[model samples]
Target: MNWIDELTSTLGDSIHCDEACLLAHAGDKWFASHLPDAVLLASTTEQISEAMRIASKYNVPVTARGAGVGYVGGCVPSRGGLVISLAPMTRIIELNPADGIARVEAGCLTADIQDAAAELGWFYPPDPASRKESSIGGNIATNAGGPRCLKYGVTRNYVLGLTVVLADGRIVRCGGRTHKNKQGFDLVGLFCGSEGMLGIITEATLRIIPTPPARAAIQAFFPDFALAAKAVQDILQAGHLPAAMEITDAFTLEAARKHLGADAMPAGMQGHIIVEIDGQERAIKEELPSIMSILQSCGSINAMSATEPEDIERIWQLRREFSASLRATGLTKLNEDIVIPRSALVELVDFCSQLQQTHDIPIACFGHSGDGNIHSNIMIPLDAKGNERRAEAEALVHELFAWVLARGGSITGEHGIGIAKAPWFEGAIGSNAFELHQQIKSALDPLGILNPDKMGL
Candidate 1:
C-alpha cells in the first residue's frame, strides 16, 4: 500500500492529504515554503501517538507543528512527510489557583491562558509578542521570551511538567504540577526547547503566580543610545527591578517618524526607552518618580509616565509599531533576535551602525534591553525592479552572527535554531557540544522521524 493509504487506514478520519491542508501547513512567517505529503489534524494525544507509530513503522519523516505563528521556519516541513498539527487539540484542562497550576492542552493559545489567569488574579508572564496568535505548544517548543522576561523569565521557567509522545509512539509524562521537582533528570526541560525534534508535546502543567495589584510605565527618549543604555544599568543598580524595559535606536525611530509621521518621534531624539513596574498601588506610584528621576538625570527628552492601564497600553501600542514602521519603509526587513551581555547594548548598536555605513544597508535595533535580546533588523532596499538584495542580506546576517559570537553572545535568544539558523547551529555550539546534541537526538529519535533535517541534525 502507498504511504497515504496506510496513514489513512490506520489514523482514520484524522489524516488528510488534501491540497488545502498541505498548503495550510506549508510554512510559517519565514520566507521558506514546502508542501508536506500529508497533514494530520491531531485532536488527542492518543491520535498523535498512533500517527507517530505509523510514521516510525513506515520510516516517514514527521514534523510537529502548532498555530503556525513562529517567526523562524520551525514548522515548515522541509522534507515532504506527515505534518502533525496540534491546533485541533485546544483545551484548558484545569486552572487551579490553590495549587498555582494550569493544566492545558498543547494547542491552547498563550493569550487565552493569560486572560484566564488574570481573571483568577494570577499571571502567566511569558508574554511573547505573538502570544495572541502563538500556541502554548509552540512557545514551549521554542522556550519563548518577551519584554517581561527580564523579571518573570521565559516559557521554560513556567513549564512544570509535560506530556510528550516519542518517535516510537510511547507517551511519557515528566515532572508534575508542583512548582519544584528534582526527582530525576530534567526530562521536562529537555523537551521544553527541543524544537519538536526529540518528541511532540501534547499537554503541559504550567506554574502561575498571583497578579500584582498595580503597575506603571515610563517612556523616555535620549540624546543618544549610550545614555539610554546607561539608564538601564542605573535603574537596576538602584535596586529597582522593573517588570519590563525596552530600548530603541535611531534608525528604528527614524523609520517610525517617517511612517507614523514626523510628530510621532520628537526632534533630536536618538534613543527611546520604556520601563514598567508592577506591585502594590502605593509602591508603584512611588517607584514611577524614582525611575523618572533617573531618566531625567540621564538626559532624557520628553519623558512621560502612565499610571493608568489604558495609558500604559497606549505607550506599548506605539512600541509595538516599531516593526510595522520598519516594514512601512518599503525595505525588506530581516529581523535577527540576537543577545549579548547587558552592558554591551550600546556597543552592539554601534557595530550595527558600522555595518550600515560599510555596506550601505540600514539596520534597526530595538527590544528587551534589560536582558540583551535585541531585534536587530537589516533592512534591504529593493532594486529598481522591486527585487530585494537577499544574497547580500544573507551575507550580512552571517557577519552579524559571527560578531555576536565574538562578543560572547548568542545568535538567537528566543526563536530556536530552526531552518533559518540551521547553517550556523553546529558552528555556534562548537564541535564537542554539537556531537552531544547529535547523541541526544540519536538516543531519543533513532529513526530520525521527528523534525527531520532541522538544526542540521
Candidate 2:
C-alpha cells in the first residue's frame, strides 16, 4: 500500500495530505518553506508513536513540530516527507503545587503553564518572547532561555521529566516529578535541546517555584551605549542580581521612537537598561534606591522606577514591542541571537555599530545584556520590487558569526542551530564535538528520518 493509504488507515482524518495541510506544515516563522508529503495532526502519544513507526517503516523523514512559532526554521520540514504536529495534544494533566510540578502534554503553550502556575502562587520562569504562542514541546526542543533565565535559569532547569517517543516508535519515560533525581543517565537533559532529531517529546513534567511576594522594575537611560554596558557590569559587581537585566542600543532606541512615537522613548536616550527585581515588598523597596544610585553614578541621563505590578508590566511592554517596532520600519529583521563574554558586551555592540556602517544596513542591538546574549538584528532594506538585499545581508551575517566565534562566543544563544545556521555548526562545535553529536544522532535515529538536514546532523 502507498504511504498515504497506510497513514490514513491508521490515523483516519488525523492524517492529511491536502495542499493546504501540506503548506501549513511546510515552515515556521523563518523565511524557508518546503511542503511535506503528509501532515499528521497527532492528538495523543499513541498516534505519534504509530506515525513514527509507519514513517520509519517507509524510510520517510518525520519532523515533529509544535506551535510552529520558532524563529529558526527548526520546525520546517526541509525534506518532503511526514510532518507530525503535536499541537492537538494540548492537555494540562495536572498542576500539583504540593509537589511543585506540572504534568502537561508537550503541546501546551508556555504562557498557559505560567498562568496556571501563577494561579497557585507558583512561577514557571521561562518566559521566552514567544511564550504566548510557543509550545512546551518547542521550548524543550530548543532548551529556550529568556530574560528571566539570568536569575531563574532556562527551560532545561524546569524540566524534571519527559515522555518521549523514539524514532522507531518505542516509548521511553525518563526522570520523574521529584525535584532531585540522580538516575542512571540524564536522559531528560539529553533530549531537552536535541532539536527533535533524536526523538519526539510527548509530555513533560516541569518544576515550578513559589512566586516572589513583590516585584519592581527600573528603566535607566544613558547618553551612550558604552555607559549602558558599563552600568550592566556595575549592577552585577554591586552584589545585585536582578531577576532580568536587558539593554538596548541607540539604533533600537531610535527605531522604538519612530515606531512607538517620541513619548515611547525617554528623552535624550541613546541607550536604555531595564532591571527587574522580585521578593518581599520591603526588600524590593529597599533595593530600588541602591540600584537607582548605581545607575546615577554610571552617568545615566534619567531613570524611571515602577513599583506596582501594572507599572512594571507597562515598562516590560515597551521591551517586548522592540522586535515588532523594528519590523514596522519596512526592513527585514534578520535576528541573530549571539552570546559573548560578559566583559565583551560593549565590544559586541561596538562591533555591531561598525558592521552597520560598513554594510550601510540598519542593525538593532538589544536583549539579555546581563547574560551577554544580545539579539543583534540586521535590518535589511528592501528594494522597490520588495525583495530583500539578500547578498549584502548574507555577507554581514557571515562576518558577524566569524567575529563572534573568534571572541569565544556562540552563534546562537536561544534559537537553536536550525538550517539557517547549519553551515557553521561543525566549525562552531569543533570536529571532535561535531563527530560526537553525529554518533549520538545515528544511535538514536538510525534511519535519519527525524528532522533531516537540521543542525547538519
- TM-score, every prediction: 0.99, 0.98
lDDT of 1 at 297: 96
Write down the TM-score for model 2.
Answer: 0.98
lDDT of each: 0.93, 0.92
lDDT of 1 by residue, 1-457 (tens): 9777888997888999889989999999998989999999999999999888889988999999999988789999999899999999889999999999999999999999999989999999999999999999999999999999999999999999999999999999999999889999999999988999999999999999999999999999999899999999999999999999999999988888888887787876789999999999999978988999999999999899998999999999989898899989888898899999999999999999888888788999999999999999999977678788788788888989999999999999998888999999988989999999999999999988899778999
Q: What residue runs in model 1 are displaced by over 4 Å at the alpha carbon? A: none
Clashing pairs in 2: none
RMSD of 1: 0.9
Q: Which pairs clash in model 1? A: none
Candidate 1's error at 61, in angstroms? 0.5
Against the hidden true structure, what lDDT does model 1 obtain?
0.93
